[model samples]
Target chain A: MYTRTLFIDGQEDYPLTNRKEVARLAGVSEATVSRVLNGIGPMKDSTKKRVLDAAKQLNYELNAVASSFARGRSGNLGVVMPHVPKVHLFSTYYFSELLSGIGEAVRSKGYGLLLLFRDPAAEFDYVSLYRTQRVDACLILGASAIDSEIAGIHRLAEASLPFCVMDQRFEHSGLSIVAADHEQGSYDAVRHLIDGGCTRIGFLNGSPQYSNSQDRHEGYLRALAEAGIEPDESIFYEGNYSRTSGRRAAEAVYRDLGRLDAIFVGNDRMAIGLMQALREKGCRLPDDLKIVAYDDSDAASFTEPPLTTVKVPFYDMGRLAADKLLARLTDKDQTDGVINEKLQTELKIRKSSGN
Target chain B: MYTRTLFIDGQEDYPLTNRKEVARLAGVSEATVSRVLNGIGPMKDSTKKRVLDAAKQLNYELNAVASSFARGRSGNLGVVMPHVPKVHLFSTYYFSELLSGIGEAVRSKGYGLLLLFRDPAAEFDYVSLYRTQRVDACLILGASAIDSEIAGIHRLAEASLPFCVMDQRFEHSGLSIVAADHEQGSYDAVRHLIDGGCTRIGFLNGSPQYSNSQDRHEGYLRALAEAGIEPDESIFYEGNYSRTSGRRAAEAVYRDLGRLDAIFVGNDRMAIGLMQALREKGCRLPDDLKIVAYDDSDAASFTEPPLTTVKVPFYDMGRLAADKLLARLTDKDQTDGVINEKLQTELKIRKSSGN
Candidate 1:
């Protein structure tokens, strides 16, 4: 029967129960429980038994997930995700697959998952989860590579806490990251289009906050340069990797569809929308707008003319991040320095690529 | 009825190896499975084969009593979900929306989300969570209604703990439940189809574990009764609310499609797959067959004809469950027994309904 109705809207806020709850349940003073648990003060046998029983029943020792782990830990791994309204991040193929992978690996390791949604527009704090004993380590789903994000991780790096990022890469060295090689994926996609007798190939990428978008852009330019085709900014369109945004870009893309023979679109969702919009405008796929999409999601095959896209191992990436982080936590594998593991991306050729 | 787990960005209609899920998987009586496990009765080899396949699909161990590590003061709200292997549970629109809503409400109330995935085939032990103090209050996502679940929840109810379930219902009174009026949604969908001159309307529904499936089945029958149309078993198909299952059911559905003018599908994913398969078999959409699906997921609008689907407020249900549980935790609302609530569903008339 503890009551503190004052709700804190802090980004790093942890749940508020303390030893007070345990003390109340055990009918013992807070000092006695704390001293007994911490092994700092002496107590009578009867007092010890009462406190111990309550503590044991309450899992007050914080031993969870991995039974092998020592006491004084919550035994939970935190997954920090950005709560962007309307995006439906969790439903997306990239996120869903990665999360499934993470769940699989985490479950195997016997650790509980603590899901914390971060407000993108708010302040960032990574240490509070550790300080509050809410999670022993965390895996950040991502967000863009903005100043705040970089700064937040930078603070985390300084704190020297155990955590890693999935899919997104920050420039900071020695920061653990598990991601797909979008640069190589994009390069292959563009190169395939170029080799397929397409001269003026345009490109559509996503938000600049995701570091991989820049990699994709660079790959786009590299493929163009390698094929001796000059890069044109006029042919480039940006989308937030949403199908709606892809449809919206159809007007601009169609205006330049005359100049460009093919365009390498970002993810498959945007590709689906862009293709549908172009189809609505009487643009025959491949003939009017040959395209190569990224992230060969489930929707790829579901599209009218099935999309040819780069398949990123999102699930494996998720699993790898969790496996690495958990191993680090357990001191199982002591391989040093920024455990950077980049999985390969395969380009799945289908009807959309006219292959 | 859905024996297959489709790997296509997945899914719906499963909880795991409990008596309900096991019975569901085995297509045998739950009592039979229990007797077999408890060595209370004899069973045939075919029954044993069914259970083995389920274990193979899950790559999971048979039921084991979850060892309790009770202790606490983590100051968190535990969200209990079945960790169904090979099914991308989080990626499905239903789960993601519900979780997002839960996340939002929990965040606003300044409580941490402790996500615990129960191995579907494991023994139910909810009391351990509270006894361990991992969570002050918990919200169960769901599984089918089974005896062990009821017993576990019965113990919780006896414990007089404040908890609730989302989008699921049990027979016991005084259990807080927040769910969608699926019966209403199904009724509206079928009635609309019937009013549009569809006499021979087929139905594709999910598993029986989900009580809503029964509601939907009832709704389908009610609509038929109102229209003075005899309900035919041959016109009914079962899917796990998965796109792949939908496609698989297409063979059987299409065999009987000559008699049916329209069909009411269980969910959007199944509709997409069913439609795709039907189209592949040289059936024209809306003209040859009309469809009204459930769950207006993002993919609902992305289908070639854009599904005419019933939009269920999954996110709101998630929010309500979290909000109510948290409110109860804070003692802000002294509401009485069994706060049962259901939200409305809307039928979105897209081209697929031939409107």
Candidate 2:
């Protein structure tokens, strides 16, 4: 008997024998025993059963690291998210929807998801995950075009790791990116508001750190130019995409609510907050002011009078990102070129747009 | 020169050399090179810089599997959640808040989170994760006391794995659990409503499959009994803790809206939906009927009339659960017994309860 302490369920010790002893007891070669234990290859049912029975009788336990070493795969995909304290990424509709899509896609592919949060302020080594073999491939999310983030992308690119970026585009042409057509979505939203007879429209946009926000701003400008409406910089208030910021922006916009016939808010969350603040100030929807928002999240339909917004398929974007990475991981020949997939967005008409 | 193709960012081939070659170039022993690469032990700053610079110059990449095998640890924690297709767990405020808390705690500990979704209806092997050494410890979330889930818990318990359940308590006594004191929260919410001069109060609850719902039900009954008011089963409606279900529940409660003075809802999502439905039916909030909800989510304050509800600390619960599991993982001697922690909840008074 090879008696040694074994930790099971973090509790009591269990007696166990060595694999060699189990092999001897089962009347099989040690290599056969190893194969059966590791589920390495196809074997005769009788031989596998005999080996298993002997191992169980002797209480033989297989070491996890040895098996992983023999298998040559960690069987997990990595999702690296930007860690912002007090931001509550999971609670936000954008992250949650995108994560849902990633989870769904990863599960369907029979791969476990390894989530790692990287603080933008701290020094992070992205290649360490691949080098340490914790994750087979990684998907980067919520990455801005900051110096460190750009350097991290280049590091991964230099190392030749299998990875994808969700919603963020890099200057590197070879980087794999899955993003929504925010410009088109914004254009449609502004066009909808323009068609509704709004001449002087205010634009409440998110921070420029994100590529999507920039695209949305461009769309807003393009729509105004096409409509022959001069872009008013004073009415364009930048927000951080939070409901509180939206409420604050509403205050700024309210000072010039007389000149502004309608407003194009960046996302539905801010739009909802803006509506609440405007209502508290005695402004009625569609009667006094009309609004068009983006990102048709779950709250859009439930908002008072509902919100007319552009729907960004965050879930699909996540799924596509995961699928693309998985494909690269599985197909050796497929891992050679850049893949830039820009998914389509739809306009959902609701009561807030004066429809 | 030995040349071989390598995948970098799932793209074209990159030239790379082995660790041994880099070690030779750096004029250091291979053991020193390994130490510098794995970040296992402290080395002289000059030697560490030399090794890294040489590796970077030569483009040396470490093999992930061999390093993991040598380290004898996965450096990851497992979180198993119930899989409900199209349900979008991330979109739900409950799961998202909890995950945020878990993520924050896990990242602070310098541990990676490995997420796995198990189908409730299918047979799942929970022990494989630990047995295969994929994760150091596991945390089970959203698990009901279904036969399979209970069996999974027992399997983990039998194996003596370092694990904890979040929000769900099993029949087994020795299982570690971290959850909110929902019964007390419910009691507080109902008591607050009763103190507001509302005598006939209806109960809108979630499915009984979850233990929290049962506790909330008990609290509702207990509060009614203490107030000397008979509980009306006719006014009770069941929802799936969704805004849509809440809207549907409002229809059933509307028939007796004349008789009911107030209603206690299971969560803020349902309460928001129920209020929308009631408003559409021309019912004045706090004038025709007052409402008290559970889970003071972000949307709770933004809802029309603003919900007065029981504040369930989901983020704190997640953080506490992660902390407990991490403690068990790090402390070998502390894993002998079960730890069941029930966190306290707070009541947030707002406009919806006529406060």
- The numbered model that scores best in DockQ is 2
Compared with the true structure, what per-residue lDDT tens digits does model 2 show for residues B143-208? 886786777688777776778988887777678999999999999999998898888999999988
lDDT of each: 0.76, 0.80
- Model 1, B111-176: lDDT tens per residue? 678777765454455665664455678888865677656766767766666688777788777788
DockQ category of candidate 1: incorrect
- Assess the local accuracy of residue B302 in candidate 1 as a C-alpha lDDT between 0 and 100: 72
Runs of candidate 2 with Cα error greater than 4 angstroms are A1-64, B1-64
lDDT of 1 by residue, A245-319 (tens): 899999899998779889999899889889989999999887787899999887788776788899999888898
Candidate 1 residue B230 C-alpha distance from true site, Å = 0.8
Best by lDDT: 2
